[model samples]
Target: MRLWQRIFLIGLVLWLATVVVTNWTGNSNLVPTVVLFGSFLVPVTFVVWAYGRGRSPRVTVELLFVAFVVGGALGVLGASLLESWLVHPSIGMYVVVGLIEEGVKLAALMFVTRHMTKRTTMDGVILGATVGFGFAAFESAGYAFNALFTSEGLSLRQLVETEVLRGILAPVGHGLWTAILGGVLFAAAGRLTTTVMLSYLGVSLLHALWDSMNAIAIAVTLALTGHAWQFALLRIGRVPHVTEWQVHVYTLVNWAGLVAISLVALCWLWMTVRSGRRRREILSQ
Candidate 1:
């Protein structure tokens, strides 16, 4: 089997084993192991796959590992610090978050790959995705850790659910967004071109929309079901109890929005990769 396949299979087995042991033994000590495995499994697999795809001379395994660990660490730290200081709960909060997070991921990518002389769009995609996946892995681990605590006590089920959900959506989230930005950045050959700026804004918009999807789905469901009064309740720190039908509608809307966003990002990445390959071919000829 390929490296990515091996990584995913082994990681999944380890995660499952950890979960079973934790459940059987009721050991809180193994919670961290479960969280780390579940959180990092998909991201590590994707990074390995991307690394295989590029197979660039300059982008060695060691460099990719550094980018994944150090770059991801830097991105999450920078984003957390900036978001904590600057962001307030508001309508535009997701937008600000998107801008800040994407900015930081780009910065981390640049910081890690700055010394490389021959940068290409593919290289950027691989490395940027490495950093992004790194961020996702770390951030998901944090989320899983937080999910362990609830109003009552430690909730392993919630932690597993959070990790599973985030793991499933990992590829289309940070990794996809940063891959687009990275492709554009490298296509410009490190220049701050208009194309690069536009790509950043586009990805940031996608990020914002993604972050706000839950709220958007709730609002849309409320509107569709003629529950406009719930909006007022929401404003005054009241969460109106939703009906079964409303819950179904909300879930549908939420998944639909996520699918739409994922499709858009995937298409953008495909086009960007195609364009980059064509450009490279032209240059070679």
Candidate 2:
């Protein structure tokens, strides 16, 4: 079967699993709805968009699709299993989860991208992002659904807010991060022996670091406040002054930073192929 066909099949099966689980519970939730849509549709659209932009390989798109499904499944399972062991609501939990999820997704990426006939730095980044995007989409949706079920008739606003934020800021949990890893691995496919291992570990560590920062902040606040109630009331009750009247200034700032980093990453990825593409075109001419 074609690579694109394989990706499509995996995506279909993943979507079906999402539906089956929701049906089994007989409960509908907003986040789940968002996850169902974002996890399944976002990557689909991304592949289309990437193709339309003339950046991604259509023939190998199937590999990306498979990466998304397989990695996404592992992420969900890892996050759930780790959540159970999160006895201390500290940076440790978040870091551990981020590492596990990213690690799982990256592993899947390596498997799918292995020994391919055509390999490029951009292709690696694109595939890695595809995996991350799939994982983040479903996870975000699952969270949204849980929120809706516990509250009023669907937290549409929250769902939109998280989706928009994550979608724009972080396509997959560790999207921009993993893209760097994939790019490196792809470039060193034939030249290096231990580069792939180093790249994977580096990406995973960065992911864990990002999550740990947030976890530490929350943990510190909880500890200093002496009580969760006081922490919620006194610390969270007050909103600081900041520029931009956008939704959740804090979130926007974080997203902005993430996007900025992504821009740098993109520049690096573009450069990796620039000379190569130019060389190819020159030869053809």
Candidate 3:
């Protein structure tokens, strides 16, 4: 089997084991252990895969570590502060969050690699991924923590379920989005060119769409089921006594939206990589 495939399999197996052990044992201490392992699984797997694929001598272990650790921490810290200060609770908040997060990550990437001169698209991908994954890992931990406690006491099952869902979705979210932006940023040689600006905005919009996917699904569900779309706003804290057919419809649309977003991000990454390769070829000639 391929290296990345092997890594992915190992991560997946370990995650499943962690989930099973934590839930079966109902151990509180094991909850964080499981959360950390599950959260880091896919992001770490993808980072390693990117590293192998790049095979760039420019991307050193120190650099990757710094990018992942420092960059990710800074991105999370900055985004949290800025989001709290700048964003209010509203419909547009998700879009604002995308802007803040993508911007902060880009800034974190810049800050982490400010001294490095020989930057390439591959370096960007690796480092951007490091930052993105770092952000994801921290963010997932927070979400897992929050998911642990509802009105009830510690909910290990809820925590594990949240981690599993986020872990499954992590690769296509922050990591891919930032990688695309980083590729464009490095391809432009750190200049804020039109392409770079547009790429950043485009990725931010995709980020917004991703964060809004559940709401969008709910809206669609309400509309298609002949329910008032405005009632979606009241969905919070109140589980509607919907028909089985409605429930199925909501599930189908939600999963389909998530899949669609994943495909879009993947396609964006593929195009960015292809563009980077072409740029390299032209420069080589």
Give each model's whole-structure lDDT: 0.93, 0.58, 0.85
Best by TM-score: 1
lDDT by residue for model 3 over 210-284, one digit each (tens)?
898888887798888845533663556555567788879989998898788889888977887888888889989
Error of 3 at 10 (Å): 5.1
List model 1 lDDT by residue over 30-65, tens digit each.
999999999999999999999888888988999999
Model 1 lDDT, full chain set: 0.93
Model 2 residue 255 CA deviation in Å: 5.0
RMSD of 1: 1.5
Better of 2 and 3 by lDDT: 3
TM-scores across all candidates? 0.96, 0.61, 0.89
RMSD of each: 1.5, 8.0, 2.9
TM-score of candidate 1 versus the correct structure, residues matched by position: 0.96
How well is each residue in 1-285 modelled by candidate 2, as lDDT tens digits? Answer: 654456656665665565556556645553355366544555555554544444654326566667777766676676677667652566366556656666666666676666576666667667767666667666766765554543455544454455545555554345666666666666665243486666566566556655554434444444543444544566767643323432244454455555554565567556655744665577579
Give candidate 1 regions above 4 Å deviation.
228-237
- For residue 101, give model 2's deviation from the true position in Å: 2.1
Give the residue spans of candidate 3 off by over 4 A.
1-27, 227-240
